[model samples]
Target chain A: MTAPHEPIPGTTIFDGRMAMKGYPLNKMCYSFNEAAARQEFLADEDAYCAKFGLTDEQKTAIKERNALALLAAGGNIYYLAKFIGMLGLNVQDIGAQQTGMTVEEFKAKLKAAGN
Target chain B: MAKIVGGVTTSHIPAIGNAIANELFEDPYWKPFFDGYPKAREWLAEVKPDVAIVVYNDHGLNFFLDKMPTFSIGAAPEYQNKDEGWGLKPLPPYPGDPELSWHIIESLVNDEFDICSCQEMAVDHGFTVPMALLWPDQTQRPVRTIPVAVNTVQHPLPTPARCLKLGEAIGRAVASYPKDLKVVVLGTGGLSHQLDGERAGFINKDFDLMCLEKIVDEPEALAKYSIHDLVRLAGAQGAELILWLIMRGALGRKVSKVHSNYHIPISNTGAGLLVLESAA
Candidate 1:
């Protein structure tokens, strides 16, 4: 493992260390860039995770389909977007999940925060 | 010899593309955001260049985590837009300038930039949305494009200084070409707005405005901003502003800001646009 660095509060910075740690998870997510990979994963997620060699924690995060959990498990948001996109979720939906709010609530917050 | 004519910068938000596709420009919710582009489109029409160097980051449409290149230049004859799993209608294939792309690759490599040269790339909204905004009509694209893809998604991102230096190298490369070509460099993505975490809705108009001001004259100063500090000040996704420095760097030491516009909360972003011409 690499030396531990200070963590930014309210943000999971996907630094080199996280990139290394989440390689399998990110690689799996990256594969979803192709439609066949997205379908294969949806058809059998466990097998897909195994094929990419995801860790137990990463596997659990995938099963839960939680963006924050996936981030905690070392998934970068860009790569994770592919995973969420497979579920018909957008970045806003992931933001809603990360902030522990419903999608509607998050959209309301965004609308209210207009400049 | 070729000359770097100028640069354009804008936020390549996907929602902006959706608005344009659905004809929501006149809607009150999107009007302010769309209001900022007419001048840009008009300016593009007036200053038509032979080629445009588009600087943007891919959102997993091409080059995934498997082998993420810190900097990738598309040298293909043309680039096709990918669906990105969102069912958005793909734009027509963009014509690429391989000759210019090759010249840039050779120049950047000689300058020790160590860029990844891609013969084929499927562009996502990062490359497409801004083009859509600027050109609006696919049949009449203002200029052919050469895409410069930087890695802003993975952390340990290229520093502002590095991006600036790369841009300078690119400027040199473009200028060194023997052909008498007019080229415009475009830096896309970010003007503040985070996309995740509890701080998901983060937006700093002051910082975004500061960038618009500083990028015109003092882009080198922006290099001092650390990635962590950028995330704090500009938000996660907003950190992509570093890409703008690439465009600024290519414009030489002095530039004239010909046009600019800024509006807030375009789907959780402080959308900004600018056209800078080389002072020389």
Candidate 2:
């Protein structure tokens, strides 16, 4: 069922529609829950995404390692967290990339906003 | 017959767990957030429930996207905390109440809520952080826990209405138990703040305060909120606040607000803490 509301700007809600659209990408990230799966993906990214049946858009997003792109391609942040973890990145790092700021800048913004 | 003692709702932010583990509460930056829990600790000391039903969402820890359950009940005797790849030191295993968990599972299913029964599950920060906040002394866990894991990670998360209904069913189930047990429902997660996308630092204090106020007495009104509305109004990660409804549901209709604390930007979250005692 579609949400009986207008879409919020600059935010891609990971609703059922996005979940279905990005299933392959999310499933691939889900595989990272296992250490061996993470290692396998690191060894051959294309082969791994192919196994999970990622779409061309998802494959590109994975190759790019862009959190926003993955979200656009149907990657839930929690699942995508595993994918980012594989790259030695944390949620703050992804947040920085999404907001087009450096990690230090993003953290500073967080501190300032809280104050 | 058993009675519902109360419900506790808090944002199970992972950073809060780290601060507590590292003893960084004394630090000025973290002091305010940590300060919010002493009253809760005192309250728990006063009315120690025999069983606490912890309602939280797993964040890619135990059940990944492979077979995500909409509602999973942990019936195991013990739940171990695991490292979620960020190297946060895992906490000591928490004891579980199998009997109560089974009762909840059977009752929820019979109540038409298809819940996945989990005999084995390792809890992430979503489960452990709140535990630490409630009972800081690891040696003395005040209550046996039955973890209720909900699907807020993947899409098609149970609507607010369904979550409220699930809680009500749990309340009925708890009341049906033959033992003279006291139960507390703990709902953890969200009060607005997104962790990703261009709106990463988003925090709506007004929206969150509104939620905190309404959740105490008018939770039924919250069921009208669609997930889309939740994400748009409260941040994406903040949408997990729906889990709070489950705890509120288990408390029955009338509840007394015992104590509450809300702070902004606890690492990209409007962290909230609330305690509601069953009016009965």
Candidate 3:
């Protein structure tokens, strides 16, 4: 019996020949991977805030508001990273942006901002 | 010998196809656009292509951002519909031409172009919406199809010119195939539409009109457009228009516009269609 879901061997999906000639696959792939990693970080708001020096209040706000939820509702986390990139911050910097004080003041500032 | 009977371009505004299939004529948004395709509908019946090389983009369904390819070709027996976040559209799967597909594959390979050959894959609305639009008659679609997937959804997508070069490669591939059949190169997606950010509703009629002009008269000129230029001028989602160049390129430099239509009832987007046949 033939096994199911087998792709024809030795086929080229994207032509690597002209890949970087006009469009650089390397830069594209790097940005995509970074975006995916940021998505994973956002999925768990609490840990993400802590790792990025967010205060308790900010962490609670992130968890409660579910900032990641905003990213999820929109298609593909890649675009969200683009938005963050536009703000001149990576996913980690997002937590810092919310909290003016160090990691200690994150939670309080988050709660204060929520008000 | 395969001659591009002509090429068709359209915005494929989701609602337009939905309105037609479900017979929702009363829909204010779609009525005008649907009415515009009467000539296009007639044209499809007249040409009756033997095999259609559908050039479109996949929205993270078959291949994700993980390892996205700039271009991917489908050589499967049949393709099912994919549910992309929102549920799948109500339609039967598409039939493909494996014989012609293999022939095109071999020819394109011999010409030194690498093509991805998929045995089992489901095509999204990018392929099906146009299918439903061009071939509304269930009894006779007149041609089988080969799905060509381009990586347009991702950030580092191929440039407009790169897409066009691939089209030339496609043209050469189709010409060399040892089949005496009529082929229709259907390049789907956009005159313009942007589905993101505060600037979500953006439309650029001048750029879109220029695209229609180039697809028929001077496709090479379009290759000079960068992804940033397309996105900035046409809106981010509007960048998908690059895929249309592939269809134009496949038809080669000698083509005449048999039919053309454009509408912008929807905000921040423009839709247009063109039919081109190889010059006699």
Candidate closest to the true structure, highest DockQ = 1
Q: Is candidate 2 or candidate 3 better by lDDT?
A: 2
Model 1, C-alpha of B251: deviation from truth (Å): 0.8
User: Which digits, one per residue and each the tens of the lDDT, describe model 2 over residues B145-225?
Assistant: 899999988777788889889889999999999999888889999988888778898888888889999999899888889
The regions of model 2 sitting more than 4 angstroms off are A1-5, A39-56, A108-115, B88-90
Query: What's the distance in Å from true for residue B108, model 1?
Result: 1.6
Docking class of 2: medium
lDDT of the candidates, in the order given:
0.86, 0.85, 0.63
Better of 2 and 3 by DockQ: 2
C-alpha RMSD for every candidate:
2.0, 2.4, 12.6
Pick by TM-score: 2 or 3, better one? 2
Off by over 4 Å in 3: A1-115
Say which candidate scores most in TM-score.
Answer: 1
Alpha carbon deviation, residue B124, candidate 1 (Å): 1.5
lDDT of 3 by residue, B130-229 (tens): 8878887765556788998888755567778778878888887777767787788888888665443333334577788888887688877877887767
Candidate 1 residue lDDT tens string, A18-69? 8889999988888887788888988998999999999999999999987777
Q: How do all models score by TM-score?
A: 0.94, 0.91, 0.71
